[model samples]
Target: MKIQAKSLVDTVAERLEEAIIGGELAPGERVFEQVLAADYGISRGPLREAIRRLEGRRLLERTANKGVRVVDLSPERLEELLQVRESLEGMAARLAAGQIGDDEVGELRKLLETHQETSLEKGYYQQSGDFDFHFRIVQASGNGFLISLLTEDLYDLLRLYRYKSSTMVGRAEQALAEHHAIVDALAAHDPDAAEAAMRTHISNARTHARMALERAEAEAASTAEG
Candidate 1:
């Protein structure tokens, strides 16, 4: 079987994206192309191609002389992203409420139930599970453009922040409860309720992100001063 160059590049890009979103590659960390190429046992060509793909996804940025680095998530940027999410996902939920099937609702219910059990057992919600719940709702909305915007364009960046937000004290439990409310609205086929619930959930997440960022900055400042 012949492996296509594009496929290989995309595979490499996916691995790098997972590393970035999983926090293995810290935000603002430089990408040492040669080192990564050597580590992956691939040539620099595919590595560069992978970097270009990640850059297109906004997961990486190239500075004038500093080369490529992971995109940093700032509080202001996080707020902007979540504001867009609230608007987009709120609409998605509203549409989903009207269009989602009974089976889809059942799937969502099972997901929520699993999340509840896992959160209780692990003492926190898994970021991947949280994303799965929202992703399922967006998929149920039956809007191709909306799906592309949320899943294709913004999903990786969303995961990065969601991973960070999941670490903020009490956020996982609160988000679990919010997920239940959103699912309740969806199950009842209440578009207005679904939209409001989604908006509130994203809004709360944005607030938590802002507070977490502020605390991080303060700690950094104190450390620098000391």
Candidate 2:
């Protein structure tokens, strides 16, 4: 593939990744190269490249005997991911507190304001904006490596969970309040406070995820029993 051709693969990877994260391709869905090629108006070659990239990213898995499919994140994996997210986000908030100044802090505050406003309008729009609010905090840490690795990708994975979480009874308002606390800590330039706020925010999100998973499992069990 030429340099330009390689870039097309990269673009495919991103779009497909977003689609998976956004739940367009639900967990365990098989990837068909032909369908994807038709949808994206690309050739099989580029679609294959995209699949390979997703597999590398751990977003898709290829069974030894079967073809590639979207990863079905078990509850255990969700718990593990939540633990890691808490620690990483805490560090990000701490670093961002000192590394970023008032201007950037102000930007975050504005984002939160918009998030709250938009959230009241509709569930889906709120879900999308909430991601931007949290991601901007990660970017404000000024850690290029962490930002590059976690920014869109991690949040993409989290987007579905975030949507689910935010839609939970009273969680949308509660999450907005958590954002307020983190913003205050950042504005104060208090690293410890910022870290604590972020830790709490992620912890709450983890709890929400756990509850959601449990509810889903229970529903499935109830259906089976019926």
Candidate 3:
């Protein structure tokens, strides 16, 4: 019984974490224990436990007396985070290319193929596939330490911007082309090419996201005054 309770808490935490990442739970939104407990059909005990778990993950932050809110990302903060992520992920790509086996490379190619099938979808699921591709690359680097360094929260911050940029004309197709270049470099076992390809891919993604956020903010300001 105790174990099942713990499991429930974990389950709740996972779902809530995804919700936060996928933007269903926006940043700065207060988390109400009573509301979520009732919605998930769980008791407050497990829900509180779940909240604490997410808090530990850095997905949620607590205020002095104001309870918890989803962690917020300012434009500068998000850009800084992207820069750090690109450096880490670029190194991981280089290491992966140096040591990855043919089978692993083939598996990554397969992920790219799957993503290509829906590349034109230009929706949440398509973007989800893109995330999966990048995640598989990082995990395949065979570095547990590197894998631990990047977590879902960091990915979430990027994903929010990615999702918005996906709606832009030609962005999804451009992103897919970059993915193909990366996979090709990795398959050829060209560490230099692989690292360069991966770095360029992240650079382009950051550019698109920054532009999208800037445009959105500008439009919002215009609408507010008009």
Find the candidate with the highest lDDT and give its number: 1
| 27-107: candidate 1 lDDT, tens digit per residue | 789999988887777788988999998998899999999999999888778988998999999999999999888888888
Query: What are the TM-scores, per candidate, against the unseen true structure?
Result: 0.86, 0.79, 0.82
Model 1 scores worst on lDDT over the 10 consecutive residues at 122-131
After superposition on all C-alphas, the RMSD of every candidate to the true structure, in Å, is: 3.8, 4.6, 4.1
After superposition, which runs of candidate 2 have C-alpha atoms over 4 Å from their true positions? 1-15, 38-42, 120-131, 144-149, 152-155, 221-226
Model 3 whole-model lDDT (C-alpha atoms): 0.75
lDDT of each: 0.84, 0.77, 0.75
lDDT, ranked from best to worst: 1, 2, 3
List of clashing residue pairs for candidate 2: none
Q: Which order, best to worst by TM-score? A: 1, 3, 2
TM-score head-to-head 1 vs 3, winner: 1
TM-score of 2: 0.79
Residue-level lDDT tens digits of model 2 in 23-104:
5886778988888887887788977988988787678889987799998757888887778778888998999999788888
lDDT of 3 by residue, 74-173 (tens): 5786689789878988988988888888888788778767767766675423344334777778876778888767645465555655565565667777
